[model samples]
Target: MEFMQADREACDRLLPGLRERLLELPLSELESADSPALALFREYGGTQLLIPADRGGLGASALDAVRVVRVLGGLAPSMSVATAMHHFSIGMLYSIADLYGKDTEIEPILERVSGEKLLVASGFAEGRSNQGILSPNTVARPVPGGYVVDGAKKPCSLSRSMGLLTTSVAVPRADGTNEMGLLLLPADTPGISVHPFWSTFPLAGAESNEVRLTDIFVEPTKILRPPPGLTAQLSELEEAGTIWFQMIVTAVYTGMVSRLAALVLERGRGAATDRARLLMAVDSAAMLAEGIARRVMSGDTGNDCAAAALVTRFSVREVLTQALDLAVELLGGMSYIQSTDVAYLTAAVHAIAFHPPSRTSMTDALLDYYAGKPLVMA
Candidate 1:
């Protein structure tokens, strides 16, 4: 945790310089030099924070990932992950080996990840599916030696310069229940293919793509945990995934919003009627963000982190939208320039809506909380 706090400070200091450099590059260019970034990445060990310390990772908390989301969201948005996002994933399954315990097949995988040799992408989204439904179209049908994973996952978050993905497939059980099992797929697998699928914000480091798994045979060892609902154990893991996801994702959007608010304040100077309003928005949102972060850090569980997260998310979207309006209103023609962050702000407003349990979904979730449905991941 101390290291994570230190990493946050380092990223804060490094971001402005990095953003300047990022701006200089063509937005269309997809590849980035891994060396310099990796140096800073190594300093913090990047997404390795999500992994466990025993496995050579920072073992940063769900909130720690949230903190990272804020930092990286501000610096890079969704265009490229500053470092690879680990599929902490089943690897987390390995880290807790004593309790839920280890799978020998995943130990070396986590070792390589902790060593920073391989990249992991998350494949979750599916086409034409209902929001918040875990049922996936990607089928992992049972076969003689292993399951044949044959399906295409749409809008999966991946790295352009890297390979490998961790995903879940819905299996039909003889017991008449659907099962979701996770898998780790290598980039070089014979039948696997990837294609980029841009989101609302072109620059959000999300870098999702369509992943097609064509009759690829995954060994039993590489298969992640058993299907969801198979036991109370799987349900617990799902909740944990929900909790971590909410925290980290909230971190990213709110971070971008925080920066956008700051930019608005810096540029809104002398703009007359709107300056005071913009200042209030930024300062208000900042206070809210800081307060909620403190609560999360103190390990406060009873508090409404979900509602606080929604408010933070809404605050970010509000501030960014206001900032863009203020930027166009204050800077006149210069706001239209391609080099301006105002342009980026314009894109980010749309980008925050990319993931599920989105603003609308989040609002519903928050409402459910108020209705006393118990702040469960639902």
Candidate 2:
């Protein structure tokens, strides 16, 4: 099932350094209301992993990206998560340009990323918002030479340190219809401000906060205007974005499961059967993601991509849920209550289920896909 062994090996070379850096950071500090984890991540060149070689970066394949993320997740779930925003955004940007010959406007941003190791924060569709990922929560109105963007992206990840923000904005058209325009802007552009908003400690180190834009002028070249009809344009972006998002996010939590197993191994406690079951679940979920990665790398963007992404998210979410439950049951109450890191990791892993296209929404979409109909999520 693991088709990309060479990519995995290349990413494996990064593990020792990643684990060392993570071990140096205290769990207490990392789980605090304020932490320097993001700084440490940038210092580690975490943003450069997935950049293409021609662009002056690590040039990790899709499989390579997923493997590295899982390792990072095992060590620092928050960092793994926050960095996923950057990795997946870069992946999606490049894929659109290279595969679909669309969104060539993102080339400049990608160049800066490859050359300077710039971090990109994603404002993609998230949980419970009801606003489809393609349907922009932020709206921009056209002006003389540019557009004036007005709206806020709530809980924007990497709020404090991102160099660029890649998001979609709803642009009003003369025909009284809206076109989705992909917007790329420097994080420190005038009128853009980040405010603390996330109160949960699970991924607190990500500093996912509120980003508000008050009539900011977005230059013409920074916007990519897609064709009309949300479903048509969105389906294209969704197929590309969902595969990487599901793979990277799922890998991160799978790393936490790995770390828990490592803890038990080091302590010489727990039955072999218990640990095997947990690891087997983790491997099953990881393989599902890897299969999707292989399909993506091979440029298979048909319904398989959509179907696999939907299935991967659902399978990983269910497996991780069971794995965490088993970990708690086998590790016992005292260890569960006393081991704060384990407790936090378990809580953090659950956040993956809430990523996007809620299970309820995906069930109908998946059925439509197999039934030879367009996949749409409201």
Q: After superposition, how far is residue 29 of candidate 1 from its true place, in Å?
A: 5.8
lDDT of each: 0.53, 0.74
* Local error of candidate 1 at residue 311 (angstroms): 4.9
Q: State the lDDT of candidate 1 residue by residue for 1-378, as single tens digits.
A: 321244366444433244345445443332222223333333444545556677776665544455555666555555323232343343334523433345445566566656864556666542243433234557777899877888876665554434466666776678977666666666778888877665454553555566778988877667655533356555444444443444454455555555555555566554566766655654454455555656656764343654565566566666656655664565456545755565665565465555555666456666778898755444
TM-scores for all predictions: 0.74, 0.88
TM-score, predicted candidate 1 vs. hidden true structure: 0.74
RMSD of 2: 3.4
- Native-referenced Cα lDDT, model 1: 0.53
Runs of candidate 1 with Cα error greater than 4 angstroms are 1-44, 60-68, 80-99, 125-137, 199-201, 227-233, 257-268, 271-280, 286-311, 338-340, 362-366, 375-378
Look at candidate 1 and tell me the lDDT of residue 270: 48
Candidate 1 clash pair list? 69-252, 77-205, 78-204, 78-205, 78-206, 79-203, 79-204, 79-205, 80-205, 97-101
Tell me the deviation in Å of residue 46 in model 1. 2.2
lDDT of each residue in 246-280, candidate 2, tens digit only: 77887888777767765665565678888778668
Say which candidate scores most in TM-score.
Answer: 2
